[model samples]
Target: MTGNAFTAVIDDTMTAPNIGEPEEDMFRLARHLGLDIQGFHTFGDAAEFPQLQREAWDAARTALDRGLPVFAKELDLGNETSLIYAYDADGYYTHSWHGGKGHEGSDAVIPWTELGRNYCPCSSCRARASSGDRPSDGVYTGDPGYGGFVSLHWASAAEPSDARRALGAALDFALSFSRRGAYGWGGRTFYSGPAAYGKWIGLLRSNAIQSFYMGYFIDLFHESRLYAYRFLLEASEHFDGRPGDELRTAAEHYGVIAKNFQSLNKLFPWMQPHAPIDDPDRRREAVELLTGIRQLEEEGWGLLERLLTWVR
Candidate 1:
């Protein structure tokens, strides 16, 4: 855990005329990172023949041996909007390409197999799903856990019979996607949409108490490693009314999590983009805040392990 500056070096250098072999590049990168490269076997392009699969496996093993998780991050301020769009633009299940012809069932963020069945069509889902219409090319995969190809159709009034129908439809869609796993994996990728600026504000405003409670409750369960249901129960406890002991208890537990995650700011910074301090005087402050957040995430895991006993 090197804070926010996580980097992974892959073998990108090529050799043709005395440049050297691919393993040489790998060794160079490892050495550049100050890592000792003893007993390192260079992986080359030996998968061009009949046993191509074996070559790929060997290459994959080489990657794993280096212990990389492919973590990535952007270090620019103005790039936020572009990055968001670029991420969201990928794949076919997103709102960008819901109804495009020939691109059916392309979203792979969600488990297409169990999408409709386990899809949580709560406010979060609706808000994100309604961001944009399906794309012309049908390449935008929707949210995770929800396949991109499924049509958006929910009855306003709940009908007892409709429950069964919805379940059946979800299951059928999940099965269809499961059958096409290979295609979806290679051809499709998914990204979550930006939060509903206004709706999110309104929800946060209208139910600040409960919302905060739920947020904290979730953090508590996460911190303590308690049953995740504890957070849900606490959230449900405060949802109908304002906040009370239950919610407060949840918040207290979450406070511990917050103390741990305060550096990283939120459990998921991707959920909201924090404003960067632009003033020269505040620049250091901003950097410190961001750095602190990275520290929280790095150190919080250990705290989580220790706090597991407090979990529900």
Candidate 2:
């Protein structure tokens, strides 16, 4: 699916409040698409770990036997999704977020026993079809819409008021960063919204952030801005005409921001685990790029404000 379609269905606003948390996003999308997701039992300590692993294994085996991929989290790693594609008497073979350099299924092999140790307190399982309605092969045969996927084509024809509401939601989500409360794993305060840009700038100037973390922020914001650009472009379509000029302008500015983020990603290349961390020259260059990004983001926010005026 196009990013626009996916984000629209997933209801992503490309803002800090929702970014950096895939579990929430996955469940949101699943709910929007009408999938029923169930949380697994969370174990608090090593004593309870075996029960958690057993339950997860049973769920995974059930799903795999039906030719369905099992969704797992926190297996031999922390805070990422893993897809169990195959399993045997030894363990479950997964395609995880932490897989080594290779084709998807070539590496990630977590033994069942290992899962008891590395698995986090929380895990989940989901099935495609509802209870008795499930097919013999577990494949969904009915219309996908019945399974909860909203039709974006129909959404594109949304009324002006509905479109305006959506635009307003986007604006609110953007502004939330500055006002967002401490809401991250372990109560960490995230500098969100416009403040996030400033936070990165401060970190760069102080040389406080490690290379991997810096790279991760760059990658995350890059993806976020890219999504923002696409969302603005799609949103602009709803405002076609004289009133839409502001929307188009906003989209253009967001496109520039997206490009700037792309450049930053190239400079940092955070996806590489062994990327350099404490290079003064690279840090200086990043500061310059961030300054430019901050300016572009402010300009985009200004345009968004104008667009909101029209919509309001």
- TM-score, one value per model: 0.21, 0.58
Q: What lDDT, from 0 to 1, does candidate 1 have?
A: 0.27
What local distance difference test score does each model get? Answer: 0.27, 0.52
> lDDT tens string, model 2, 1-312?
112211210011111223233233243233323344554523234455455567667777776676654665445333344566787887867665544433333343567755523332112221212333321111112332232100000011112235565556546444443344234431234544456666667767887666766666677667867777777777778787754777677767777877887888887785645334467888898999999987876676666666667776
Which pairs clash in the backbone of model 2? 33-148, 177-192, 177-193
Residues 156-251 of candidate 1 have per-residue lDDT tens digits of 122232322322332233222222211111123211111111222233333322322323322332443232224423433433333233334444
Model 1, C-alpha of 109: deviation from truth (Å): 26
- Cα error of candidate 1 at position 302, Å: 2.1
Candidate 2: lDDT of 152?
Answer: 7
